[model samples]
Target: MSTATVNPAGGTSPAPAADACCTPSQGEAILNAGQAEALALRFKALGDPNRLRILSIVSASESAETCVCDLPEPLGLKQPTVSHHLKILVEAGILHREKRGVWAYYSVVPGALESLGASLAAKP
Candidate 1:
């Protein structure tokens, strides 16, 4: 019988089977083409350090919303540059934009981050 070997490091480890290593079972894809494309865009939007900082600021707001006007000061970026990053995030569906009079407020989309985490989970 085939069996796993113990490493003596206090954790159970499964045996590595060469035959099973590269074999793919007949199963549905982890992500469909469209879902992959959408997830890719969201990840791409997050690829930039500036965009990640912008998301962090909006996420930490007291009211769960922050005005675009308030972003530039903390980031030390100009309004136009901040707006450009916000636009990518909004297009990626990671944030919600609400225009209030002259300023635009941004908030994290409900369960957006959780959904993204779930998508990349190790187990379905």
Candidate 2:
């Protein structure tokens, strides 16, 4: 059954029932809460320019990794500031950190960026 409503011309038209508006559409894929939270953390880490720059520098390094001590000069940031960004990236699972004697080195996690891109391109 439908309800009647006045149109712009002042004639009555049958309007859809209220329940019809609440029906869930089929075949739509949606992220669950946990997935959304995880993605948000990763995206949030990438939100900062410094963090993105850190990813770029590390990815372009000869060994596909970079030493913590080597970041400050190129980034124009202090050691502590660069370190802070690196920590966020590591926590977000976008980068991996390895401690080698006196310095920590960072590299991008395998397939992490690809997974993120795939999530956006996913179909129902």
> Please, what are the lDDT tens digits per residue for candidate 1 over residues 18-69?
5444433345666778877877898899899989999888888837689988
Worst 10 residues of 1 by lDDT: 17-26
Error of 1 at 22 (Å): 4.3
Q: For residues 1-124, write the lDDT of model 2, one tens digit per residue.
A: 5444333575333454564444333344777788789888988998999888888888897365799988899889998899899999999899999998897889999899888878778831
lDDT of 1 at 101: 93
lDDT of each: 0.81, 0.81
Candidate 1 local distance difference test against the native: 0.81
Any residue pairs clashing in model 2, and if so which? Answer: none
- Candidate 1 TM-score to native: 0.71
**Best-matching candidate per TM-score:** 2
Among residues 3 or more apart in sequence or in different chains, the pairs in candidate 1 whose N, CA or C atoms overlap within 3 Å are none
Compute each candidate's TM-score over C-alphas: 0.71, 0.74
Q: After superposition, how far is residue 100 of candidate 1 from its true place, in Å?
A: 1.2
TM-score of 2: 0.74
Residue 77 lDDT (model 2): 98
